[model samples]
Target: MLRVFQECPELKLSSHGRKMAKFGRATPEIEGLVVASGLSPLIMCSLDTGDRRLMSTFVEYWHKETSRFHLPVGEVTITLDDVTSLLHLPIIGVLHSFELLHVDDVVDMLVELLEVSIAEARVEKIQCHGSYVRLSWLHDVYQMKI
Candidate 1:
């Protein structure tokens, strides 16, 4: 089943202590509580560029994943094998039990998925807000006659 769901307030990383506009979606907030225990909703970011700020949120560890290896399923004990398979990439980073290289593989993955060079998309105006690097055109199928 291809379930397409988004958290109404997907992520509440407080950048520069600004309030997040509620996304106005139907779904409830994604309460990643256990790991994100003490983290404030506003991130208060001092990063200069928008892309960096946006990417930083993903790179940093969220509260929910801390202090335990909790997964959606009932049983707890999760292995790097599990995360690696889900992400479809070999696990790399502090695996706690094994050694591997390329700790920031996820950053590369995000950049590729967005199809933009993080180096180039880093701009001043987009500071904090970040860049919407993709563009699409939708031509009128036919003009409606009034």
Candidate 2:
């Protein structure tokens, strides 16, 4: 399962002289909160335009039924430890799950979590096209709270 596939050919990637778009980073005001949540490592990460050819090769070799990479040498799949090590995220913690079956439930969740008025929650739900609000709006709310 851990053997390397030497039969695979080397990948060639081309960027076509195109530059990747830059994304906004977290504000300094949110630094403390991000650190407290154990996500500060993500802030230090850099972005790059990825290799499409390599990604295509991986996709070509992927076996959805087995949920593993069917390489020449062996089957490969990512584990929770791989995610923990690569992303520096906590693996052992209470898992939170919730389900909202209706718009009223979504409105109630928004009101309870954001501490906004029921009318405001309903407006946000409508503006966001049901059951979801924009992250920017949530950021604004957080800013207002702090």
Best by lDDT: 2
Per-residue lDDT tens digits of candidate 2, residues 26-112? 445455667876767665544344766777678678888998998888999988798789878777777656565588998886676
TM per candidate comes to 0.20, 0.51
Q: Cα deviation in Å at residue 15, candidate 1?
A: 19
Q: How many backbone clashes does candidate 2 have?
A: 0
Best by TM-score: 2
Task: Score candidate 1 by lDDT.
Answer: 0.34
CA error at residue 74 for candidate 2, angstroms: 1.6
Give lDDT: candidate 2, residue 80: 79
lDDT of each: 0.34, 0.68
